[model samples]
Target: MPYYCDLGPGQKVYLDNPGPTTLITLASGSAGQQQQSSTQIHTGPWTEVPQIARVGSGALLRCVTAQGTYTWQIQGMQIGAAPTNAWVADQATPMQATEVGLSSMASMQPMAPMEPMAPMRMGDMQMSMNPMTMRMGNMTLGLDAPAASTQQFCTQCGAAIAWGDRFCGSCGHQLHQP
Candidate 1:
């Protein structure tokens, strides 16, 4: 059996599959615009469908089962204001630190001033500084300059391709100028 329901914008539907294996498919959008379809297999008792958002009023949900009839339920309903408990709010209020019988002796005492240390000589410490330099023929080996490149990513699969590569290595899609 198959079931259909119209869902509003920013609304989500939940299906309760207490029976055997069930296949669920969702379709949404208008005729001119591209319609999206998502299919999933549910073996658990409860499964939530993907959130659907339509511009005007064109959101539909379809659920079908092969073994037996399935049940469907809708979630994310706009209900009224939630009920409040006065006793819970009063108990949730935090008590003061003094009222809780917690006292910090360090906070009550004045902090001592820190003294400056004397500068030690290089000989006093067992460390030494050395300047290093490397020259590859006439050019100096340094990371000051950036490397030149014309690398680009493929539009189809987003794989890293060289500046003038013809095809993508990962997805094997052709790259051409139109």
Candidate 2:
């Protein structure tokens, strides 16, 4: 978009988009009449007048130069990255119900109905949580508990055994399967 500068009553000079690094031109009407650049408006090697204040987006900038006084309006293509007051929605494109190799029904398969998960039942479960202290610089944080051993032991000899073991390792005791 172009920037409009008010020269006087019933007069406007269109300037090329006002970006800092871009070479600003006096867009169609004022072309070749006066030589001006974005650097001249922003940084200013102006003949007499320099920039007055930090130019706001969509705000009028009043400045004077060898050409004349100009009331340049900052509209489109701002000096830097600025937020626009427009809202845009993101939407997905609709896909066709047919594939190159597969049949049309293959792309439109019936979804499986979801069922409720079975409720978990824990009978006589014993747990002990051990929190560990972690130190980083001056911040100290507590870590998650380490898992406690739930290994099965032989009742007669009190020897550690696998859950489905028929006999204990330490003593050759036969284990009763529950």
What global local distance difference test value does model 2 have? 0.39
- TM-scores, each model vs. reference: 0.20, 0.19
lDDT computed for candidate 1 = 0.36
What would the per-residue lDDT of candidate 1 be over residues 15-75, giving only the tens digit for each residue? 2233544333233345454233323355443233322222223322223234322232222
| Number of clashing pairs per prediction, in order | 0, 0
Which numbered prediction scores highest in lDDT against the true structure? Answer: 2
TM-score leader: 1
Residue 135 lDDT in candidate 2:
47
Ten consecutive residues with minimal summed lDDT in candidate 2? 87-96
In candidate 2, what are the lDDT values of residues 74-137, reduced to their tens digit? 4443332223222111211111221222211123356556564333323433222254554445
lDDT of 2 at 19: 35
